[model samples]
Target: MKSALGKKKPLELEDNVCRRTNVFKLRGNVPNYLEESGSTAAFQPDGWGYKSHWGMAVNVYSTSITQETMSRHDIIAWVNDILALNYTKVEQLCSGAAYCQFMDMLFPGCISLKKVKFQAKLEHEYIHNFKLLQASFKRMNVDKVIPVEKLVKGRFQDNLDFIQWFKKFFDANYDGKEYDPVEARQGQDALPPPDPGEQIFNLPKKSHHANSPTAGAAKSSPASKPGSTPSRPSSAKKAAPSSSASKSDKDLETQVIQLSEQVHSLKLALEGVEKERDFYFGKLREIELLCQEHGGENNDLVNRLMEVLYASEEHVSSSLIKSMNSPSSRRSTDSPSVSDNFRFV
Candidate 1:
């Protein structure tokens, strides 16, 4: 379970177990399994970090393997032999996650290599470059190797600067077949003029009409006639009236079209307003019906209250009459009663 690195590590155990499991699974269904995971190193235009590079490397290796007409077993075997590792490590290295991490010196987002199908083809260049990187790591020690952030910053700028320099160098030293500027210019100039039809179409309508030979001939025809000078002014005056009439007709037509469009739009707006009005009216009717129902209930409640008040008044009047007619009341009223009796007699 030990890695090429001398020290024992937890990752080594986990990596080994994963690799073994994957290898056993690969034997069960080679094409199916690989197809399911092969795209792990597939190119992703938006990817950053080691995954992008790993994908590029995989693409390059895929092309080589396709050219060589290698089979899956041949590729796997080649990977194992080149890296001095077992089939499990080879499989893991071909996988998108491990491939990127192994090359980039840091783990990146999970990527599926399923689409790559022949991911093992990437093993050659991957192992070669990885070995070189590992050699540097051994010399520097893992702890002393550049931190991921610093490495990214330093390498990114360095690569950019190198790319710029390379571009400048290539531009300066490039000696491809030189094109003659004079010949190119002459060739362009010698090109046939644009078609007359195209030129006519490109001209303003009025200008095009004025430039027509037929129009010039027609204008000259009357002038060419002998003794036509005296009648020219009259003819022009007549033509002027006709032209003005035609222009007025066009203006009227445009006004009619505009008015018609306005009418149509106004009609649509009126219909919409009517619909809204009807909707509100319907709501108002519902409210009125509700009010009528409530009014009936209120009237019943008022009638009940009035009947109770009338009954209460009648009971009080009867009670007062009875008290007045009682025997004790008659004695208290004896003088007034005797005077009343003498008057009656």
Candidate 2:
């Protein structure tokens, strides 16, 4: 059994890895096998043909295999390879723990122990695996160093487009059984028809005299009937006086109410006007008192000035008259007659 299994080709393991990578791609998630670049190769015991710890062993043979030596280019190449794999096959190969472990190994310190513990709380933690992987990448600032868009090159965009298309297609095609018009009509038709005799019994019957001309004439001329005419008019005439009286009383009440309201409004307005007039009248009286006091003072000053002027004029007139009468007598006064005589006649 050991000899037969030992003869198994290395191509078989490569094929398995390829198939696994394809499965991971379908799930829109990163595969673990890509991170196996630095992992140790399977070491078989002497008696056993197959290696017990095949996943743990790192291959030292490959030149670009070491995790420490692996650069951004190497990581990008791994991502591209994963993206290129068949999506359905990759889904079959991927596991949450394996993917987590791969990311933890690839980025070294990016995924913390706390994050791993948080995963236990989730229902279907694998669904969140991509987000965790992106978080890990972001933590290391891997997007800045080697942009994810350049590496993936529209893979995420393509997936999103596919999802949108699928959703639209599903909604457009969806038809509920309850809402089908044909089914509803069929259900209505399936109900049994009602009995004609029962329908006739349910209908209202016409009276024998319904179509009679006399019955129609009687109904049409009800007001023209001898007994009905006098009673109707008498009752109507009696009701009219009472109705007219009631209407007249209502109108008078309404008019009285309106007049009262108008009177009340006018009284209020008049009171306001009177208050304003009183206020202004008080102010006018105060102004009149002030004018009277100032007028008295002015009159006293004018009278005093007039007395002084009159006294001065009288004293000057008296002195002039006295001088004229006394000096040179009539001779000095007659000397002024020369100037008077020289005046043009």
Candidate 3:
């Protein structure tokens, strides 16, 4: 077994790998060998062999030989028909021929004796081929023939170019845009720049009427024109007969009396209203204090009211009995009820 790692440039000699297995016997579509592009190699009656320019008896798997099953005449005929050359032309056109030339130089005394066979399970067969190639290259010691990194990077770039080309074509067709070879992309244009004064809308401006001095001065005047003459008072006087003057004086006196009476009545009414308001205000304050004393709970007022009602039941009953014993339940016009003093509570 050979190591995938720690082999000096094993990956470079990929073409030199070979494989042979019984499962790939030449019958039906079964392949006996494969070419560089993974196509099956044709078989011939003459058994396959490999020989260097300087001959050496080196045994190799059947897969290593390019003509796995072809007869010598068959190979010669193939070369003559396709390339119009003899065995030399066929050897030249062979996929690994260039690398083999280097290998022959590197291993002057080594050459394949038996051909390597390709199997139906060709993927596994290729792995076997890679192992054989690494072994052969190691035996030949052809370190300078190829560089693995350069080959790998070249293949990677090829795959990337194909992917990018396909992606660009797809994007252009999907988005309905003209394809640009240089950019290899298609999309909408970038957003435009905003207006310079766009931020001014965010702030509120003061009204001109509110800030002007003339507006304030106009408000103070009572419909007067600016810089105009003011009105004057009358100065003429007139006299009347004594009797008529006396009658006018009597009428004025009566009007004054009536006005005085109205003023007195209004004053009394205002005083009564003020007293009533004070009484109710004091009662509301007392109720508030009572509520506070009872831990600020409104239900406590209901309980207190029930207790007062229970305690006053006897007194109310006695008052009812006395009223029944009296001559009248109605109040006389001379002695009014306490409510009559200020009835509008």
Candidate 4:
């Protein structure tokens, strides 16, 4: 139950940019600061508490990750083993109250073995070069924590200039969505009254001559010489019953085929659902028998079995048939009657 951080030594180093860098390296990436030549430790980015000639102060922390890893308890035991192997110097770093406090604030209580084992390596380096570690974290400026924003990114010029540019960009692209009425009106020309129903007046009338033949011609053509027109025969109404009937029959066949397939699919689904229901019913009966035998409630047995199996009620119930056949479950169910008989005797 003890925290890994709780096991670390608590140290209040000189609060400055350098010390902050050291803390960052310890907490973040320590192996990155390791020296290749066994000379002064070098952190590629300067803020990470690596100083030239600060021999042995820098710790190189590294760890491996696994797919299914150990719990914090297992990790703690592993860390203790690592400390024993490493001459106990690194172990000293973790044991101090200062390191403890730092870890307490830095990590959640149960850190995985990966992060701790990695930090343990750094702890080893820190112990070897404790003085360098101290200098790495030593303050160069009055400020304890470095202003990473200003330091990492070059200081920006007056923000007012940027704001001005943004305003110019906005004005150029402004769509009158948020325009002030008075200011917008000042920039606009006076509007004229709209002509009423201009669309209706301008719309061309639909031409009857264009749609109908004889009637339109009679209306539009010069009055045909009064008696010149002749009568014409009317066309017969068309019917193709045989073709239509055949087409309808084919359509009905297709629909019947589709309906049959749908019915078959539905039957399969229904069968599956029925099977599942039956399984659950069997499980419930088995649980009932178990409860009666054990002098326990059926509902309680069901709930307990569901918990033990880590399955839903339906799933557990479905498996009850198997449970009923199970010798162990049947024995438990039978044991209760014997107990009751003994009591009676």
Candidate 5:
């Protein structure tokens, strides 16, 4: 464990700010520029990328959220769909692999994904992944403190709060690039399984087959015994993924992302249209109310405006003309400028 820890350059692990201006930039909110030249790459408040991370990534309603609603399920679904992680809850993301990958997605070729574990079985493994995440955060100037202890505990509320902020930051920084979680992790999702199931396939299939007997055991119900590894050859049970299947899955995931983006755009457009519709409806309603309250004094103008408002789209001008010439139409000398109705607006 000491040797493993030694391999990674230990973090400064303390804050001692003696800047030229004597200003201390707060955590995850300040620019920790190593080079005085001011060239930075992480989620800094001044950064064009992940600038929102310093502030409230908690309020995920902004942007597309990239979803129809930024509800808990929607947030989790977005994560699972994007990362191919079967995350039923936010606590599953406590390992911080997903966030590291997110940073990698935002700034390509940063985090060493090979060192990062997708299936962190042990607490130490989770810590290792989070350390990598912290390194990336530090490198990129992402101004947020990762509450490792709380997160590693896999508490729902803690993880949910962090992930909600993460989702917002991701949406803010993501530039519509297709990120393959499977490919990113070298086709090893290390999908967070239940405690018992976690032992079955924590490592790569080949490694598990050789190191553990769970694969060759071939027993359908292996939860009864995690240590029992039968010597039976289990080549059929754990075949390497075919290139074709992998490609198809990638294509499908790509399509899903594209469709989701399109759907988000459509939703935004629909909202704009609805707002405009309501605005016009409200204006017309207001005008109608005015006409109802004072039509006796301004019969001709009200009649004309009413005819136009009630006109059918199939033949707008014809409908207005018909209403104007109709025998039942009211006649009055008072003709106010059409602008009166819209002048207040």
Candidate 6:
């Protein structure tokens, strides 16, 4: 056999600082490529080479080649089309539930979809959804940084930029699988009704005639269906709750009495304050009426009063202001400068 030792090709290894894994699995309905708004390079069959997504040598995965930019309209359309809803702005994504669904679309079963509250109306609830998204990101080991603090504040630029970055990441890894946004959410915001017992903690009644807490609870209790007789608890089972409820009701009544007394006192104080305000206002109004009766603004006394009125609220000396606004002062202010007649031409 011919000697193969010297004939062996020198071992050559390429230095790839930005190394990437050739094998990766992604499931998404969107095309697996990023492009500028109007350009469809990677999306076309000619551009779909081995390096690209769709075809066989065209290196479509070259990020440096495409100067992709997402406009507001394009981002909104992408979001609406993927989520199957109408979202006029990206700031609405503050709730974070939609982002949780995004993770689900990228990596199915990464999060419990039902836990996301689409109808969450509070800031804390929004934070909760974001926390869930963070946890999911941790589990998936995604390298992206999420600015939860800035994002939760719902700033337009912050959220828009984040969404744009996410759009690029999504396009690169998407496996071209069909995903149903509605079915993935399993009906958004399936929150249970508020318990009748919890309504007791609501803000105190603002009406003049406040009802007792027990009465309010009774009113809030769910009513029986039409023509259906309501069932009563047995005496054995009801005795404990009856005693406890009575004790609680007694405490509530005491609180109500104390609050009512405080409210009454506040109302009386307010009335006294109003009377004082009116008394001062009436005195000023009477002086104004007297000024009008004498000779309107031109009268000397009226002018002096007006001067005092126009001056700062601090006490002013009678001599500080002139008795009337002279025509000489008016002419000085209104006429052109004396230098106009003697310009250095």
lDDT of 1 at 124: 29
Model 1, position 193: C-alpha lDDT score: 16
Q: Best candidate, lDDT-wise?
A: 5
lDDT of 1 by residue, 1-345 (tens): 333323532221222232211111111322333244444532222111112222222111111222233344554464344323244322233222222222222211222122112222332223332333433333222211222222222233432332232223222222243433223222222111122123222223344336444455457655446755656777776676567656766775686678678767766776675466455535534553455346546677654433332233346478658968888766644466522422210
lDDT of 1: 0.34
Task: Write one digit per residue (lDDT tens) for candidate 2, span 1-345.
Answer: 122324632122322232221111111111232233332433222211221132221111122222233333443344224223222221121222223334444334555433432223222233234335445543443221212222122233333332233223222222222233223222322111122113222223555356444355447653646655465667775565566656655775686678678767766776675466455535534553454346547677654543332233346478658857986545745466422432221
**The candidate that achieves the highest TM-score relative to the unseen native structure:** 6
**TM-score for every candidate vs. truth?**
0.21, 0.20, 0.20, 0.20, 0.39, 0.40
Name the candidate, 2 or 3, with the larger TM-score value: 2
**Tens digits of lDDT, candidate 4, 1-345:** 112434644323343434422323333333432432243544434222443442222322222132233443444343344222221222122312222222222222311111222222222222222222122223121122222122111122321222222223222222233323223223332221122213322324565335434344346546436877533431121134345545666775686678678767766776675466455545644663464355444567665653443333345566776866888665545457422322110
Which pairs, if any, clash in model 5?
28-143, 28-144, 29-143, 42-140, 213-229
**Backbone Cα, N, C clashes tallied per candidate:** 10, 15, 12, 21, 5, 7
For candidate 4, the lDDT comes to: 0.34
Q: Give each model's whole-structure lDDT.
A: 0.34, 0.35, 0.36, 0.34, 0.59, 0.57
Candidate 1: TM-score? Answer: 0.21
Q: In model 4, how large is the Cα lDDT of residue 245? A: 48
Model 5 segments beyond 4 Å from truth? 1-69, 193-345
Off by over 4 Å in 1: 1-230, 299-345
**What would the per-residue lDDT of candidate 3 be over residues 61-95, giving only the tens digit for each residue?**
22333433444355436433432223332222222
* lDDT for predicted candidate 6 compared with the true structure: 0.57
Q: Compose the digit string of candidate 5's lDDT tens values, residues 1-345.
A: 123435744324227542321123334323332222243333434222223323222112223433443677887888878877787776677777788778787777767887777777665567667767766664565556677666776777887778867766676556587777778778666677343224331223343234333434445434536776655455444454344445655775686678678767766776675466456655756785686467668678887876565443345667657977998666454865443333221
Given candidate 6, what's the lDDT at residue 278? 50
